[model samples]
Target chain A: MAVDKNLPILIVDDYKTMLRIVRNLLKQVGFDNVEEAMDGSSALTKLRESRFGLIISDWNMEPMTGLQLLREVRADAKLAAIPFIMITAESKTENVIAAKEAGVSNYIVKPFNAETLKSKLQSVLGAF
Target chain B: MTPSNVLAEQKLLRQRIDAAHAEAAQPLSREEVGDIVREVLTTMQGDLSAQDLGLYKELESLARYIQHARREIAAIRPADIRDCHLPTAHDELDAVVGATETATFAIFDACDAIGVIAGGIDGEQGVKLTEQITRIFEACNFQDITGQRITKVVKALKHIEAKVDALVAAFGESALGALEADPEPAGDAALLHGPQLPGNAINQDEIDRLLASFD
Candidate 1:
């Protein structure tokens, strides 16, 4: 399977800086079509309103966390298969295991670069 | 009846005084002077130092703990209160330090990335780098966020100090409590910012591997 750089991606985080960084990293890795959401609820609204190929979100947030967002997406029959990636500074084994069990397409940790993003995308979406 | 012994002591002291007077007026010897002076000074110090030794001990305990706690707070500077000697205040100090380090990291990492753009890269690369810089700029917002977070800790510290002050006053605490009020920073003591939280810092590679393990 070939990854599509043209597909729109949504990046969610409590920090605006992170949203921008992830957006840039995605663009650097040839995934240019990126959007932003400050929290899971907004991401869900956007997910319902518009089409996004992927969701990359931070694990810690108020109102809703990335994990909660992932769960919501997975539970929604229409949006269940949209390839979600949980990105966060939290590396606790229980958290990762929880996300893994929750049906996340993948996960990424903080301070990652373009190459890491590219590879993660490839592993999940196949070579592009 | 100590008449014999008492009479002999009075006569002996009188004889000595008379002898001294006869030669030249003599003042109390150094030992006598010290004893007389000590009586008055001891009473004054007791009045000034504390109501009693027990209260003084209480005061000492508070002072010593605050001093020790401040050292722990100092260690918290680079983040992580894991090394603090006093466990009671570890969480409080760690909160302030962690927020401080996070803010510092945001500033430093932003600057470092901006340093990376030396020249021309085109299309996606340029766009990505541009977004990266913008993101770094956005990260600078951590200052206000962390500053706000730290303000709460500062408020808590002040509140605790104030309550301690009231306790001291209610207990007739000594002037030493003022040291905390007008804290004199000890020695070359500045908050030492150490390193990032080992748990929080993870590179993208690690994430990739973790994700692979999931598969």
Candidate 2:
């Protein structure tokens, strides 16, 4: 199955630079519709306000962490089924397990390239 | 001697002799003996009290000296190290993050511009240039990792600074002022502080292996 190139993707991270990088990488991977949220709280608000086909979130955000956001999304009836991908510099076993338990569709460790992003997207959204 | 004077003198001597005789004839009463002993002890105690007063004064002076030394030490303490130095260090690190982020974004902008230019080309050179742009994007990721690593160092520094400030607050800087500092680790030994931050001890592959266990 071909991945939807027009699928709206939300990329959440506290770092603005990281958001830009992810946006660029997503653009490189042929995903034109991408939205940015600085943190999980804003991401949650965006999720409620609009629909996104996939969520690529950084785990180490303040106020509301990505794992916390994942749990919230999983709990919400409207957003529960949306595929969520966790991206983080924290490549710890416990963090992965926590994200896994929280119903993350896939995980990507940071310093990842566009290829890795595309691969993870394909794993969650089907082959591109 | 005049008869009257002689009689008076004799009478005085007689009285003294008689008193002595009486004292010899009748041993001192237990109450009298006790009074004599008590008097001697009272005198001795008075002497001891004088000696103790000198010792007590010396002790009081020593206590005062200690208090004065503490105040002096506290005065000499670099009171602003925590307030100025540590916080400034943190701010400097924050600035470094900001500067790097700016530079990284600029690099991204150049890469994006090059990417747009590359998109216009029709040959294999364009494809190669596009591939090179992806490499630049990947390489630019160092900014994020560097920022995270610097943040960990900042946090560690902040933690130590907080502890020092707390100790100074509780015990006065004087309490810790006299202590000698331990030598800092050198070379790679400094980095041996056992996985102080996330992703330090383990790699993504190891994490994945561990996660496979959960499955």
TM-score of each: 0.46, 0.67
lDDT of predicted model 1: 0.67
DockQ winner among the candidates?
A: 2
Model 1 interface CAPRI class = incorrect
lDDT of 2 by residue, A1-128 (tens): 67779999999998888888888888888898999999888899999999999999998888899999999999999999999999899998998998999899999998899889988988889887
Q: Per-residue lDDT tens digits of candidate 2, residues B1-215?
A: 99999999999999999999876754333345556555655667756677666755565566566566655545545445676668777877887788788899899889989999999999999999999998888888888888889989998997878876764775455454655544678999987753223333688898899999999
B1-215, model 1: which lDDT tens digit per residue? Answer: 49999999999999999997765633233344446545655677837654565554565566566556544443333121212322335444565656655765666576556646623665777656666664564455454345445546666765665555554443222322223333545766644535434454567899899899999
* lDDT scores in order: 0.67, 0.82
Model 2 error, position B139 (Å): 1.1
Looking at candidate 1, what is the lDDT of residue A53?
88
Misplaced by over 4 Å in model 1 are B1-215
In model 2, the runs with Cα more than 4 Å from the true position are B1-78, B173-215
Candidate 1 iRMS, in Å?
Answer: 7.1
Considering the true interface contacts (CA pairs under 8 Å between chains A and B), give the fraction that model 1 also has.
Answer: 0.03
